[model samples]
Target: MSDSKHRHKSVLKKTDEELLTDDLTHQLALHTRQGHNKFLSESIIPLMLCFACPFFVRSIVFICDHCHGSIHEFLQRLLFDHTLTLKDVLENFFFFKWHWPSAIIIIGFLIYAIIMTMLLPGDEYQGPITDTGHIPIYRNNGFCYYIVSLIIFTILTVVLKLNNLSPTYIYDQWDAFLSTVSTFAFLLCFCVMIKGKYMPSTNDHRSSSNWLTDFYRGVELYPRIFNIDVKLITNCRYGMLSWALLSVIFCMKTFELYGYTDSALITCILTLVYLTKFFWWESGYMKTIDIIVDRAGFYLCWGCLVWVSGIYTLPCYFLVTHPKQLGFQLTILILTLGLLSIYINYDCDRQKIQVRSTHGKCLIWGKPAKIIRAKYRLLNGKESESILLASGYWVLSRHFHYIPELALAFLWTCPCGFQYILPYFYVIILFILLMHRAHRDDQRCRLKYGDAWIKYCDLTPWKVWPKIY
Candidate 1:
């Protein structure tokens, strides 16, 4: 306990630069001895809190009297009237909602995604090495698959509408989607708890003896079911596909209700384009922090399955009911600005990737790319070399890419106007997410690159914003 206390104090005594560099990397030693699962208590709790969002969205946004209504009443009564016991709270929210139609939809979609993954044209990418000696290879066909899926979806929608056979009640799929995904997550957890034959991820800490913690952390680094990569299927195909489709449906519903309004249209167009861009840059994403560092745990799996499709569609989701007509001039300006931000972000990422690919031999902004050679040790003890580009957008701010990305998110979100707080939820979340990611990436490099990281940080001082942050 004394040693742990001293270590914590010593960390606090470091300089601001050192602190920023070392932030989030140093896991404080726990004084209390616990099972392996309990070791991740710090991480698991935050993830659990994030879990609340799905239920909140499903219950509140898409209100069902049987489920959320009772829960809300219970909460209000407890807060303003009487105290509630633990059993009361659990019982209040524990009714099963079996939307048989949505079940078919979810199952059919999964089957469709698997078929598309098999048929689509994609390059096999070798990711960063893993604890298991095998290097992870993923088939990235999201762009082609998404395009084909969208076309087929459109044709079906059109065909059904012409014959007046369209499934209108399908609009209520959000609640059902939430319920079905929750079941999948729980079942996955149970599977992970019992199955030890799979290749589990190896990390700094030992495996937790606690079943729930082990399940929460995941039993496999990469779980393959019926020859499908769970991460790729859940994160890219199911989540991204659902998010995009939901936005489309919301916009269509808005048009059906209020003729044609530019506000909803603008949001819809930007969202579709943004999602398409994501698919186009799918390979680039395969090497990101989420895929490379994060385990295939509940944080990621449930997030991609449930939270992503719900929360990410908020801007357009709100617009479905509250359609406003922004004039042509304002619409043009917003679109122009958004497209520009998207371009800047894409180009910035392209420059960094190209320079690294070319070993700093390429030109950046009409000048030779300048970079500091930095070496880092992988989690598995293998050494890797990377050159930090100090020229172009990176020199302006270490995370200049985030600025344009933020701009892009904000401009699209502006269509919601100042009338309601719900639409701007994405903008606020994006800001926090970016800032947190910047800190995490910096800390990771500080641990990995050591002195080389310090030098790199010195060269480009500003983390994101110009001279402010």
Candidate 2:
């Protein structure tokens, strides 16, 4: 092969050590190996391209269709010729055309969730100790809010269809959803910037004091609005519930366009079951890294608002047009495998929680929960105990949970079929996300646990996949 081709291949095959470095540009460059053939096949690249790549695709196609152009010219057209002007952005902001319905949707859902949270009876559960040496007591009412959201979604879908209007109105209001979600993000960031008086003591660390980064990372550790937990509402209600709601809309749209198929039903059922499982384990979720460890910054807030509700449901959206008629037997097989994966994933988590809660007095696979008492230091440099599990699914691999979770994601989208690559976008992105998350978690434990973490690793003998990574 030519030297240039050899160099390109070498660049693509950068050492895992290089990828593990804290270099954003280098990571971005490596991810570019996943070029424009398809989205889902590219692994982690789809997460970024899902926003920018597809939007420019239509314009690129239009330009190519109208004018003959070489590959270089096409790429140049994609970058230089397709810039979004301020006027177009402003026009999308207005509620005149397609924006009004989605704007109403934004307001209606926000008010309903907020009001439901206020009216619903809630208890308090103190979270893990914060970096600033405080355990935050969060109001726990996500279950009730989950029920209310289901009711609202069902009512709206029925009411709209009964009035000869389409229940899948959201599919046509993509622009509206974008504009409103952006508006929410803008207002919330602004509000967070000005909420100095409301800042939690847990957020005393300003890191570098860079306003842009801090704002993006968030100023408050846990910001509440008038006695309501903002994180629960934004992350759980808005992001998670909106995910389910959008899936429902996509299901309706598919039925409207093409009669119900096993593929569509499977997609809808997997989505609904997964989301319902989320609420069923709402309290268990509160203890997760997103709620306890991560900041409520743009990465989390805007991500949940925009990315989670929109791109997360791409499989269902793709299935709307490319409906797969996977026969009944295939559908059942896919679902059975998917549910088994979900159960394994859930059981892994349950085992860990049980070990921690019972102080290693729990059973794993009909035997005692094998655990090592790992001593760790908190952000405040104080000592704490972390029960490092060595039993159950964890005994198979350090991150065996993620393996099955990825499987669950794949099986969930199997109905989308293999004809087009778009439907498996979630599966690819999720695997990459989980792998990255696992690495982060590993680094975090290494720092916090020090020698204890090293010992735990020695005992476990894996980071994610055993004997591979």
Candidate 3:
């Protein structure tokens, strides 16, 4: 009887496996068919529609707020009555044709992609499920879509370069093209990707006052598409887009400086490298980091990459290409600042991670305290815990990482030469954003740690910049 029961259990397990395998195979075949059909539909689409986008944008020169009057009346008022100049007309034309439309289209596509991807079919059989008790197949699809978009955008950029289009021409138009295509591709792939669950479902409620509940709530607002949560919006799309846009601007400025030089190539390479890094860090790699910190969002990462990295480093390329235009002393100073800032930032992160690994708890001053509980989901739906450390660098300052970050920003913006308002805009923006982040963080900590946080704050009072905030 005992032998028969054991054999029955083994047979049931095998049956489950067979069922899962068949389901997966059927889904794969369906996806292949769908892909072929999609490709055919796209190929048969009219070429005129594809080519006519630029011209169509150019033709619809004016966009009017249709509150009381028609577009014709609005244009007449602005052009004739307002005495708008040719420059004004040109500025409005580009802004409408590219800037506004691109922003709307990209955002719309991302949202739609995320939603559709979640609703698609698939299941989790191999890995641990997420909070929804399913594998994160949608999140994987979102990542794939983002990668495809980036490749498409890069190709378009290369094509523009090959055509010898003036920097100004590319700058004013390429963004729109990239944005449109990326958004479209994201939507396309999102519609077809297989689904999987990353978290198992559990109804065991130990208590209503669980700390994990608060954390989960926080994660919800952390900004995600479908069920895939991306913690850092600024670092991913925003940062990459900012760099691309800055590259266009830099190219124009570089042309004005040394005509055409190898410096331009260097700048392009660096920009691409940074963009690639942004994607890598924002994807599953960052998700792994979340497992450690238990803070799975990209808010801080996004802010650093987009506002800080994009605004600062990208402009330096232009300055390097045009040393004479920016002056010698200023250039050297900017480069020095950037190098130092990067060094400090890396050091801080390295120290923090090392500290966490070696010590089971964070050490403030010389005293060690137990903190940072690890939470995981198992098949039977129960919580488990393990110890995490914070000994080395974290003992020094609560947020030593913020120092290099601010420094890097200051260094990158230095090359703008303080000649125009746009150049220094980065510095102003970073200061404001960081300050806001610091304040928000403070509030969160205050709520989370209560007396324990108060003690931590007492030990290390400097939020970001030491002795400044």
Candidate 4:
């Protein structure tokens, strides 16, 4: 094994960037040898860490809320207060009762979404080519769907005067809503795994021998059911729409309880603007890591179905219980920060989309844009060129958009104060999630573009933070 030892020594002598490139290449080689798609990993252990969140993190959050949003009081009461029995504690903190109303509502929403997809008129957009030479198609009806859904919701609550369909109903029944969503998400994950394994709807699939990985990591990149795009429905329509609606509901709840508060108003406005921007840029998002790289299983499906609803709305949810007035000065400061962050995030995406759409003939900051002609090969040995924008915010960091995203989350949640860490949960989780995504995206692009990706990385070394990361 002298040759092997010599090779290892040679690798050890390489520069950091070279070493990273070699490691990425080695990982791809291993995946190829293992008969797995080199583009999508067989094991998603890093992502699967989120699996524990539903069981553990959510349970703790529920318990904290149950104890009136006081973690210390909850612990003290649990340890010292012998009035609570084991059964009572378990039933209250851990066990979730299946509320028929919430369950039916969630199911109805899904069915309604499916029906809307079938009936709605939307522009057809083609996605990036997959490893299996399939180009997935998506409907650009997200913004229209969002507007229609909001109007209908408003009609149901204000015009129809249905108490059950009130805006604050979901927040009122938070635990039951969460329970129904988690159960549905779990069952949906199983169905997608089965479909990907035996009844794949598209040629863009990569099934592994391991069923668990297939279940968690997903076997298909773009899996459709009943002529509707599954990712488009679950991610954009259901999950994201739910997040927006929940923000409105939480704000309504806060007003209903504590009257008008600038904190809630600011939070609600910023959240809507952010989600509106998302719908406005929905087509561009289809090429992102969530849709393009991650598949349609537990990590994505369950995440959209459950995590987005539960975790992403943590700030708004927290404000419902702990409503406080930040007055004018602090509120204005937070609002300004949140708005600026949203604009930066939007501009970052716009810049990249403009550069690519114009084929790098665009201007950045009123000057000619700088870009790299990065080339990559398709699975069928066909070569293609991609313009990598190295100007504007992109020059600051590879994933500079994520910085503003994090800042926006923090700015909105900052009004919750530091009395308890519950409100900061969204910011904390988003930080970890974005950091992982940035790294995962770097590795994926490195493997896809090889030397060209290496050149881009050399030109932009930072992942998400400039001069720091």
Best by lDDT, which number? 4
**Model 4 agreement with the true structure over 364-412: per-residue lDDT tens digits:** 9998998999765555555567788888999889999999999999888
Write candidate 1's Cα lDDT for 1-469 as tens digits.
8986576667756653454344232222111112244445745664565456554556444422232324455566556665655555443333335567777887788889988998887878876654323467778788999999999989988998999766434555655656766666656556643543334433322244555555565555566666677778878988898888888888887778788989988888888888888888877777777776555666678778767776788777777666789999999999988888888888888888899789999899999998999865443445667789998999988899999888888888888888556567678888998898887777666655678888888888888997986
What is the Cα-based lDDT of residue 106 in candidate 2? 80
Q: Write the per-residue lDDT of candidate 3 for residues 188-305, one digit (tens) a residue.
A: 2222111111221222111113222222212222233333544433334444555554564566556655675433533444444434444433333343323212222122332233
Candidate maximizing TM-score: 4
Badly placed stretches (over 4 Å) of model 3 are 1-162, 166-168, 174-238, 241-249, 256-333, 356-396
lDDT of 2 by residue, 1-469 (tens): 5985576556546643443232332323322322444333333333444344333323322232332313355455445786544454334333333356677878778788888867788787777765446676766787777777788678877888789987677776565566566667656755765563345434533332345554555656577767666677788878889888888888888888888777888878888777777876777777776776556666677767766765687777767666778887898899898778777777888888789789999789999987889764444556567788989888777888888778878887878766545556678778888888787677656644557667778778776787886
Ranking of predictions according to TM-score: 4, 1, 2, 3
**Candidate 2, residue 232: how far the Cα is off, in Å:** 1.8
Better of 2 and 4 by lDDT: 4
Worst 10 residues of 4 by lDDT: 25-34
List the candidates' TM-scores in order.
Answer: 0.82, 0.78, 0.48, 0.88
**Residue 402 CA displacement from its true place in model 1, Å:** 1.8
Q: What value does the lDDT take at residue 268 in candidate 2?
A: 80
Worst 10 residues of 1 by lDDT: 25-34
**Residue 317's lDDT in candidate 4:** 80
Q: How close is candidate 4 to the true structure, as a TM-score?
A: 0.88
